[model samples]
Target: MGGPPGPFSVPLRLSPKVLLIDPVRMLPSLLVPLVGVLVVGGFSPRSYLWAAFGLVGTVVFALIRWATFTYEIAGDRVEIKRSLISRSIRTIPLERVRGVDVSTPPMHRLLGLAVLKIDTGASGGDGEATLDGVTVGEAERLKPLLLRRARTEATPTARPEEERHAEGVPSERVIFAVPRRWLLYGPLSGAYLLTPFALAGGAVGLAFQWGDDLGFGRNAAWSVGEWLWQRPSLLVAAMVLLIVAMPIAGGVMYAVFNWDFRLKRRDGYLVAERGLINRRSVSLESRRVRGYEIVDGLAERWAGVVRAWAIVTGLGDSETRGQLLPVVPRADATAVTGDAIGPYQAELRPHPPIARNRRLFRAVFPWLVPAALAGLLLLLTGLTVWWVLLVVSLVMAALGVPLGLDRYRSLGHGYDGDRVAVRSGSLRRSTAVVERRAVVGWRLHQTWFQRRAGVLTLTVGAGAGKGGYSAIDVSEAQGRDFPAEVTPEWLAPFLNPPPGPHTPSDPPSTG
Candidate 1:
């Protein structure tokens, strides 16, 4: 496939399997026409002809796209050429290649096909270009050559023999994979809890939108509401059915999304690839990964499970930013973090360097806004049922207080010669770790309350992962002394000069 890789040029068409993948991806676009045909079929037989025409149009389009798309690696750039109406050539320099993400969906895997997405930190478009369907073998060969500089040892004394493959055995290690038992957590992770409410609300909204067309007059809405109000048993059954259906749907989604999920440590980057139907692979260069965000929600924490995400720039969009590791035991997550970044203590030790009670109050106080609003509503309209809602809101605020307190308790900052760490959140706890070397700048911020309380947030700025991590509500002295302690010489000019003039030997002068 493409002349044995290694910077050779050859025109390659997308795998024929794309004919299968494209139609499914285009389902949403095809639905409007499909619905139109169904509506017209009620009046005439011409609808069948229209449906056949649409089907032919979609398949021909996907075919034309597959035929036109071709790419080659020649010189220092990987070039992609494609066209349906207008032809265009997009060239990405090898050195500018930040990452090459390759994914294999279930269908793709069966076909031995994969998608190659090239992200060059392009300002627009999630990625520069994607070769939607390509041979897995070709992708493997090209991956090493494209990322050769990145994967190789930086030392000048590095040997030719060290090239993981200039000979072809990629040093890919499995970082993690989803365990079968964790499937239960999948429903909990997704929309299962809220699915019933969302589905019910959506049904009501849609019914209102198309009621007249469906021969349900405007008065039909109020009539249905009255019927539901009169029949508590029927409403409960419907709710129970929705609730029961939600978990099943959530479980299905979970299985589909996390099927064969794997995180692989490969030449110079970490690749997270998963999915059953529409698989995705995201590659994060080690250098661009300034830090890692460890996520553990209340339930996951209770279950002793934790997940981590790569905190990298440019992949800020939630969909593209790949999770660094899968849902594994909390202990395992820690061990992996230590292995990948370095030994992080707040993770190992946990629950230290807590924010003061005032900070805890500040955190918990904001959650009461919903309860307050509910009370106001109850006062204006003395509905008996609203009392139940107000009670629930207050109960939630009560539950949230401890969670908020726990979040404040989770606030911690530490450094151990190589890395600086910050931990925050309780309901959804996160610990960010950045190498001391990756830090580009330091900033200390103090609000009026913080000033009065003698505390400030110490912000550590780096090139990766949203650019900054703050040590929330840290003591003033800690904030002032942190930069000097961590990156000593770099921030000395902006901060106090390392106490040179004020050294103990020269401290005799009161002036």
Candidate 2:
């Protein structure tokens, strides 16, 4: 039996048209080794024999299998016939198709081919499956057909006017383009400054190689040291120069690579296109967006650059889960988020105050342990022994004061009618919004330490495939009442009820 399908035979020729992808260009990837032998002059006479064998073998394989790779657009079902030996055939109902994406990599671009990926939402698995090595033009034509079929099948009983309006209306679209200056300043400049250190390191290695070639007999190390010593001042100056140059260079590179990055909105979708050497474009529907967040590092924060990203439910796998947008300017985050999420933007709540619990020690008293240990060691060494403990305690208290203040400053939360929002971070800030209906369960716990302090923690659980709410500390009084108030009555049954005395006391056990 033939091993598997190779694009060759035309199967079931009934179609808008059966467009045969050019196979000659694809044949190169299979023939490179044979060509390599002839070019390298290794057994030149035998090279022709190998090349001929390779070509004929590949062609025969392609022809036998091509008949198995066929796609028939019959009514609303897309029948994909693939495989050669086992001959597996599958059909995807048009109504279940969620979205389609088309990508053209550099190699595919050269051959005018494109890869079409179809995402059938969560039911289809983690993400989409791809059909690659199709002609670019054919893939483009297939997009509209798939989209039309999906839309019609999804809502087949629409009125004639509604159908006409749907056809006439343009789809919502958004483009993500980075500003040119930022890209030039960020990563490009960094590479330029780093080149010098690389050059110097290369020169040192080459000098050792030259010594070996001239039969210097292992004295190259001393020669290398002597060379450096002779230019000690110059060496020191060069080291200082590089230390100052790298960051500047890095900034330029970041600016150049990210320049002209723009996210545009059209119809009901968001489209992202980026890259300097190689361009890429991607599009996704707005309804598929589960949530989005803004991220900022210290430098990015001070520079007022905020990166925006989204949590798309079924579009990503383990490696790419929850990554929707790349980093963009902080100023653009709000506008872009609002546009993409539509009316749901109102449900985008800020984080609650309890989320700031971790920041109390992390940000406020980072040096407390180190400082106390140093004082204790000095005291044990008989230096300032009497006052060391008192001094350390006082210093720790001073640090704790500010820690508490900043913790309070960073804590906050809000809720829209249908969604809950929580915000918390120390050096970095993050805000999360979860739909109320998405919450499947919740719990309230009180640890001994928290109970003594009159505080308790709350945890919220959502649907599978989404992370649950972590233990967030809040006033014990507030915790007892939070679950009942935040969770709907429908979800209340799913929650573990608070422990209490049995209303119907059990009869005393008979001995």
Candidate 3:
């Protein structure tokens, strides 16, 4: 019989095309040095020669890297070995694998290549590794091989589904797909709305830096300002156009990033596929999914749109990885959450009315301080601008009442069957649900004001997404009993025994 196998028995190499891809990936690192050379050496032949040398060096380094890197599925573990001088080997047990992400950037897609990322679901992201350049077929092949053992082990009872999925057949079914109209929620998400502005600011900053380097920054800035001052109507038109473009730009980016978004489910995994320029597909093991979180940004709530994500264990850091449903109508989000996790329709229990008072007081107090400060400043300096500031601060304080009411309305917690749900927040309202079994601990927090108000905050701790979800400002009674009701095994024993019959004990008489 042949000897068992060598250390690199079935070693696999990345696509040779990595020679081109790797160098391009390293080009960003060469920028600063190249720019420095150009700045110091000017556009002379010497600078060009130095730039060429750098490019050659980058290409050579890429070649060495490509030659050294090799990965393989050896036994029950996936092994990756790389580095030219100091060889390093990384081994991941098949059983610990929780997810696999495959992404194809525009360049990779053009070259028919993909990048495979292994997610071992380590809380610290220590076991995660990315294979940057692989043929599309190889990525697909490796994905299944790496995750197959994990899926089988996770769901030993799911024999039929596992068998079908293992054969590379179409065993998966679509749970939800984002409609194009739903893209309207993109602007309401509030993230994309500022993205264009942020990019513009960054570009402007870079332009100013370059202008300064070339010695015309101040003059250019002054000229632009003077020109804008000269043509006030033109400036106004430009401002209007910019305001109009923000939402449009946000919508476009959202669509491009999430075009044709689809959530599908196989036997033991939830598969999410999306992206336009950079197509991405991630497979998350269903067994580790604890529950669901529904988020409503302030604008999204006003628009009646929301987003949902699976609360999964060991997901770690990347919010996109747990996305169960992107921005959509509240009804659609509810359905997706129900389908992703188990269905629950229990009405959330509201907190005491005192809690509402607390919310309102807390909300307005911030603006009150500023308004008071501005009023004091105005009185002391008699400045018109300070008066205007005082007026604005008062108006903001007035606005806080409605915000406080909304936040109060958002605060609720309830339990149905074995699941507990808590909703809170104003700026980014979120409703988080977790199975009773998933409750790792319960924490009670009461500030001096809250204690005087007979209310406390109860935080539910779990091992999954975000780790802790709080039911802010509940009655002291609810704080004591709610946790015990949800997680009797852990909290019930710790509960204070019901007060013994109103005992009237004699007080000490000694001085």
Candidate 4:
């Protein structure tokens, strides 16, 4: 056999430079020195020596193996070749490549290296095959090349704007970045990182104080309060420090991660790019998106911010999926939404007073159970002298009315040609939009209690993961008409059958 066919049928070469990162493989090497230090501090010297020898051997072997691995972009394909004992090769066509993501962990940042991930949309999925170490400059240079390749392989079509008005589909647009301030003030502000820090610090301080009280350490005389007092100025300084440092740090991180975020009009596609030290970009074709939703909380409303997200297929395996724009001004929500979903407007529908009557008796009313339980415990334990359960039940019932009213006010659905719109919320008001062709199914339901009250509920289902259902409770009369009035023109064929030729149109020419 002639040299077993050299890797590829054509001659190929890679750049001489190779970036090396031994993330988990470097763990044993790091542990050896710590073990040696402990051994010097009066432990087993022989054990330390053996461990060191093993670690060194492993590190040397890893380095050699890693050095033998190489990759190259040749013609319209990517070639990866690596071997220590048994050789292996992988070739990916250019068309299969989705995008490349480059990340720099803190350690990699210090070393001026980045993790270059080639997302090939392989059967293995996104972030599938990654080369974990490359210089920042090299990663950047490689990005355009990979994106260009993906673009070249992609089919040419109409501009995003033109595609928005395409028949049987609601138009959608992509937004890359909103103001950094909005992100910080909105969803990002609620990030749970601070809660853990607060809890951990409190626990540690409490443990230290308890240890001191037990005379465990003579030097540990400080309580958390005393410690704070000792550094009174420092505590104040720390508060001031966070106040100033947080926004700057957050803004910088947001800017970098979300840097070069561009929302563009591509035919039937929405593309989003965000990452700070590590960059990520996503492209969602129209068919992959299930629906659109608007999220508005009290904070969002007070800040004039509104967030929008979509139910997407194959995108949100991570926590960051489901959102196209994590936060934006409420005013901008409409415009940006219109851009993404062409020519659809929100309309409010009035609900009859009877429609809301059942809300007071259903799940919303059951919150009284918790309040009543707490109050009964207080009374029985002699914690209070009053008939607290009665008082608590009254208070809960009072709150339920407003809750019911808000739900009633917030519920509505409308259709513009083949597009469907439904709005609902009590605190975080929201509107969901979907095209008729996009609806997978629908259902009408009535609980036994609802039937007794002469009311029914309807839920509209779509294909996306999160915002798939739009539900509302209405009077029985309204329920009967709801499907016909809201069904989009494109979906009418599916919802109802054509009238048969023999079906009577009039009352038998009625007289």
User: Against the true structure, whose lDDT is highest?
Assistant: 3
Q: For model 1, how does the per-residue alpha-carbon lDDT over 1-511 read when each residue is reduced to its tens digit?
A: 2323445646777778779878777877777667667675863668877877888888888888888888887766788897878999988777677777777767788788987777777644466778777889887777766676565434342223224533455567776776777777766554455666787899888777566544455578878999998999998998789778888877777777777777777655677777778777777766566567787777778888877877665553423555766667878777776655456653322332335566556655665776787788889998877777778767766876676667767788788777888877776777788877778898889898778777788888977766788778888778866678888887667655345654664445777
| Model 4 poorest 10 in a row by lDDT | 11-20
TM-scores for all candidates: the values are 0.80, 0.61, 0.89, 0.65
- What is the C-alpha lDDT profile of model 4 across 1-511, one tens digit per residue? 1112232455332222332346354775466455545555465776667666766776677677666677766666667777878888887765455545556675677667777666543334446556666677776666544444323333334444534434324444445456555546533433332443455468767577546544454355455457888888988886676655555565555565555555644434566666656655555554445467787775556677776776554443423434567667766767766766554654655555666776556535686776677677776785554456657676877888877777777778777766677777767678787776667667788888777767667677775544365556666666666666665464577655566698654444545
- Model 4, global lDDT: 0.60
Q: lDDT rank, highest first? A: 3, 1, 4, 2
lDDT of each: 0.71, 0.54, 0.83, 0.60
How many angstroms is residue 252 displaced in model 1 relative to the true structure, after the best TM-score fit? 3.8
**Count of clashing residue pairs in every prediction:** 1, 63, 0, 6
Worst 10 residues of 3 by lDDT: 1-10
Q: After superposition, how far is residue 44 of candidate 4 from its true place, in Å?
A: 5.0
Q: Show where candidate 1 strays beyond 4 Å.
A: 1-7, 20-28, 34-47, 106-112, 123-125, 152-169, 188-192, 195-230, 244-249, 278-280, 313-321, 345-354, 363-401, 494-508
TM-score preference between candidates 1 and 3, better one: 3
Please, what are the lDDT tens digits per residue for candidate 2 over residues 23-142?
Answer: 454565754466565655565778778777877776666665665577755566556776778877666655555556666666666657666766665543433445566677777666
Candidate 3: tens digits of C-alpha lDDT, residues 4-34: 2433467988999878788888887777678
| Candidate 1 global TM-score | 0.80
